[model samples]
Target: MNRNKDKAWYIADVGDDLIYIAEKLNTKANSEDYHFENELLMLKEVLETLESLECLKEHSE
Candidate 1:
């Protein structure tokens, strides 16, 4: 098994998980739950950074 490829897949999975959590938070938050806003924004930023990572791209065989 290729370790680098496995690592990339793991990162991608984490990104997906973050997206799901962010969506759930968005749906659950209300006026009284303003704290969720910061958490959601931070998740978005982390996902963006993950997308920008070159290692996430699949190399051509």
Candidate 2:
């Protein structure tokens, strides 16, 4: 999901930022930090989805 092509892809910016942070914190061991990291990834997905929906709604108006 490369999104650099279009300025409408605001959600993509958030997704890419999360991916960057996720790459840096991968400790490869089970711990609270790992769980927290996973949660962040999940939240990123949810946020991107919500943003995409909002964009669609605005366009349909």
Candidate 3:
């Protein structure tokens, strides 16, 4: 098992929540929404990176 599995899952959960909130708002009509969108994007990247690391750890073990 990946040592960071818990952390990875937590980050992914947060990212999912952010994405859901952004989608629910769907504030693309307003420029202010860009900030949330950008944050969601960054969080997605973090989630992906953590997931990848977790995969690597699993494979190594």
lDDT of 2 by residue, 1-61 (tens): 2333454465666677667656656653444454565657766776777777678668866
Ranking, lDDT, top scorer first: 1, 3, 2
lDDT of each: 0.67, 0.62, 0.66
Tens digit per residue, CA lDDT, model 3, 1-61: 4556865686667678777666655766454544455656766776787777678778878
Which portions of model 2 show Cα errors greater than 4 Å? 1-34
List ranges where model 3 is wrong by over 4 Å.
1-34
Per-residue lDDT over 2-53 for candidate 1, one digit per residue giving the tens place of the 0 to 100 score: 8678767768777787878767786666445556666667677776767655
Clashes of 3: 0
**Among all candidates shown, the one with the greatest TM-score:** 1
- Candidate 3 lowest-lDDT run of ten: 28-37
Best by lDDT: 1
* Model 3 global lDDT (CA atoms, 0 to 1): 0.66
- TM-score, prediction 3: 0.44
